[model samples]
Target: MKTLYLVRHAKSSWKFDVIDHERPLNERGLEDGPKMAAHIAAIMPKPDLLMSSDALRAKTTAVFFAKAFTIPDTEIKLNHKMYDFEGRDLVEVIKSVGDEVDTLMVFGHNNAMTNFVNSYGDLRVDNVATAAFTAITFEIHSWQDLIPGKTIYHKAPKEL
Candidate 1:
């Protein structure tokens, strides 16, 4: 079984009126990042690999989660494709992940994240709020085998 933890990046700050990609996490995001990380650490198995969007907010979110989980030597890979990627792009990225890591975590933005969940999850969730988490379990041997309706857990941090 392969487990995928889809984590939307924490809330971003609008302090700077700049490009959306340049925005950083807000105070809520800072607090929520660690809180959400602890929640994930309590139940989910340690992820062998973590892939995060290159965007500032997304990378920061990944760093916080990785530190909270104490995943030593686990680096946050910067994937530009994750930024504003559609469902197909996200799927392709997952499929390209090295087989050495069975359990994985992906930190990215919404629209695509929401699309991915709706396309792949078995349960019905309205929206994956900022810093929210959704865990999906699949019976497939590889990431490519993961398809719609394979999710086992669709939970948000608020629900925890």
Candidate 2:
């Protein structure tokens, strides 16, 4: 069995003069990131792989969860492909995960995160809000199969 946790990057500061990929998190995002991360860490097992988009906002969000999991900086993976918003790159990245990883955590943007959860998990979520987390447990042993799995949890910062 495999468990996947998909986390959307927190709210970003649009006030920045930089490009979209360089936008940093806002105050609320910074607050929510650690809260949500600690919440998940308390309830779930540590992830075998912690991956995030290389974009500034997404990577910052992942750092919070990584710290909660006590994952070293060297163990965290930053992938530029995960910066995709369409979910296609998300699918490609997820499918390419090694079989040795039984549990995986990924931080990225939406509608990719939202689309992925709706299509690959049993639950139908209208929107996966910022700093949201959704976990799906699949019966398949291979990541390449890409079938619908049981949606175990969907958490939002507001609900915490």
Candidate 3:
């Protein structure tokens, strides 16, 4: 079975005068990002790929997991598509990942993340809070087969 880890970016700081894309993670987010990454390391198999939104908060969150998982920085891809609030776009991105990768992690924002999990993930969860993670296992051989109720585990940061 293939596994997909959907993680929401850590809490962000509004104090930044920069653009939304440039906003950084708050103190809580800094602490929680690595904590959740360590939590992920303690349980799931190391991720083969880490896809993230171009936003700084998302990239920072992904970085923690990349380091904890020992996945090379080259394996992480930052995409602007994820910055948009379309869950389908995220799904398409996953589907397009080469079939060679079996386990993938995506660090992104909510509304899209929550919507994707609720639609494609088997678990019936509400919001995937900041630094939260949900693991979905699928029977399909490729990412294209993802569907609701296909997920087997939904783990949030709080749960960790």
- CA lDDT of each prediction against the hidden true structure: 0.82, 0.94, 0.85
Clashes of 1: 0
**lDDT accuracy of residue 4 in candidate 3:** 88
Candidate 1 vs candidate 2: which has greater TM-score? 2
Estimate the TM-score of every prediction. Answer: 0.91, 0.98, 0.93
User: After superposing candidate 3, which stretches have Cα over 4 Å from the reference?
Assistant: none
RMSD of each: 1.7, 0.7, 1.4
Candidate no. 1 TM-score: 0.91
lDDT of 1 by residue, 16-110 (tens): 99898889999989988888988888888889888988899999999988987887524778899888656667788888887667888999988
* Model 1: residue 158 alpha-carbon error in angstroms: 3.1
C-alpha positional error of residue 11 in candidate 2 after TM-score superposition, expressed in Å: 0.9
Model 1: pairs clashing at backbone N, Cα or C within 3 Å:
none
Model 2 lDDT, residue 126, Cα: 98
Residue range 1-160, candidate 3, lDDT tens digits:
6888988999999997999999999999999899989888888898888999999999999999998888876678999888857687898888888778898899888888989988877677778789988888877787777655476666666676
**TM-score rank order:** 2, 3, 1
Error of 1 at 154 (Å): 3.2
Q: Specify the highest-TM-score model's number.
A: 2
Model 1 stretches with alpha carbons more than 4 Å out:
72-74
| lDDT tens digits by residue: candidate 2, 1-160 | 9999999999899997999999999999999999999999999999999999999999999999999989875688999999999999999999999999999999999999999999999999999999999999999899998789999999999999
